[model samples]
Target: MTMLRRNLMHAKRYPSMTFSVVVMPVILLLIFNFVLGGAMQAGVGGDDSKYINYLTPGMLLLLPAYMTAAIAVLVSTDVTKGIVNRFRTMAISQSAILTGHVMGTLIQAVLALGAMLGVAALCGFRPEATPIEWVAAIGLMLLIVFALGWLSVAFGLAAPNPESASNMPFPIIMMPFLGSGLVPTDTMPVGLRQFAEYQPFTPFTETVRGLLMGSEIGASGIISLAWCAVIALVGYLWAKSLFRKQSR
Candidate 1:
């Protein structure tokens, strides 16, 4: 708890990190929904005004990716500043350091997601989910944030500096664009379509879309959970290994 408070307080002291995490997605939401929404809707056979409904789910996925960069940078900053070494001298559990970063990122991700959803609502995004579906959607999103938070921690611990850490997760932020987030995969060329359909973000976006819009979830919910589990496991193991090496 002490470590967690320290992480959160550090974020509070540096508001720009939190601001970027929240604002980037919202800015993209506005640009996509207003500037390119008509062309995108035409391509996808959707109403221009209704593009927000389609875009918002994918935007939700971006929140975790954005938060990942912030967490990574923050983690790398701690390492570079010798804060982690200082903590190592203390009597606290070693795992608390990473856990604090993961939990802090998760909390910030959730709040940023909520703010984006509110912005989506203002932009004419109306979900057809029932109360139960809302709960399920929230749960799924939390799982995504949790999984990605650990991944960010690993990225942070692996990078030698904050600048590299920030750059490492750029591919993650771009995954949504390559997937079915902006438009249907069917609209893409053969090779691109195949990649878009098979990527993790596609199912993640699809599952959320299904839950919010009352569409068929089919196997996407299960696939999404499986992906989250794999990512979280890999991230946990990698982070543990890296931290141990650093401790020596």
Candidate 2:
């Protein structure tokens, strides 16, 4: 808990980091819903004004990915500043440092998600979800944030400096754009369509969309959970090994 508090305090001191995390998604939501919404909606055979309904879930999925850069920078900053080494000299749990980062990022990610949802609501994004469905939807989003938070930790630990750490997760941020986020996968060419359909973000977007908009979830929810598990396991193990190596 101390470590978590410390991380949150750091975030509080560096408000720009948190602001960036919150602003990017909100900006994208506005741009996609306002600027290119008509053309994209027409491509998807939907009304331009109603694009917010389709875009909101994907934008929600994006909140975590945008967060990865900030989380990575924070972890990288700690390591490069010798803070992790200082912590090692103490009698605290070794994993606490990394866990603190993950928890801190999760909290910020949730808050950012809420902010994006608010902006989405103002942009005419309405959901048909019941209370139970809303709960499930939120649970799924939290799972995604938690899983990605660990991945960002690993990225931060692996990078030699904060700058590289910030760039390491760029591909993750692009996943939503390549998936069913902005447009339907069917409109793409065969190769791109297949990739978009099978990517991790597609299932994440689809599952959330289904939950909120009353569409068929089919296997997307299960697939999304499986992807989260795989990502979290890989990230946890990788970050643990790296931190241990650094300890030596």
lDDT of 1 by residue, 11-104 (tens): 8998998998899889999999999998899766856778889899999988887888998998899999998999999998999999999888
Global Cα RMSD, each model: 0.9, 0.8
Which one is best on lDDT? 2
Off by over 4 Å in 1: none
What is the model-wide C-alpha lDDT for candidate 2? 0.91
Per-residue lDDT tens digits of candidate 2, residues 1-248? 99999999998998998998899889989999899998899766767778999999999988888888998999999999998999999999999999998898878877887898899999999999999999999999889988998999999999999999999999999999999988889989999999999889999999999999998999999999999999999999999999999999
Tell me the TM-score of each prediction against the true structure. 0.98, 0.98
Our tally of clashes for model 1 stands at: 0
Pairs of colliding residues, candidate 1: none
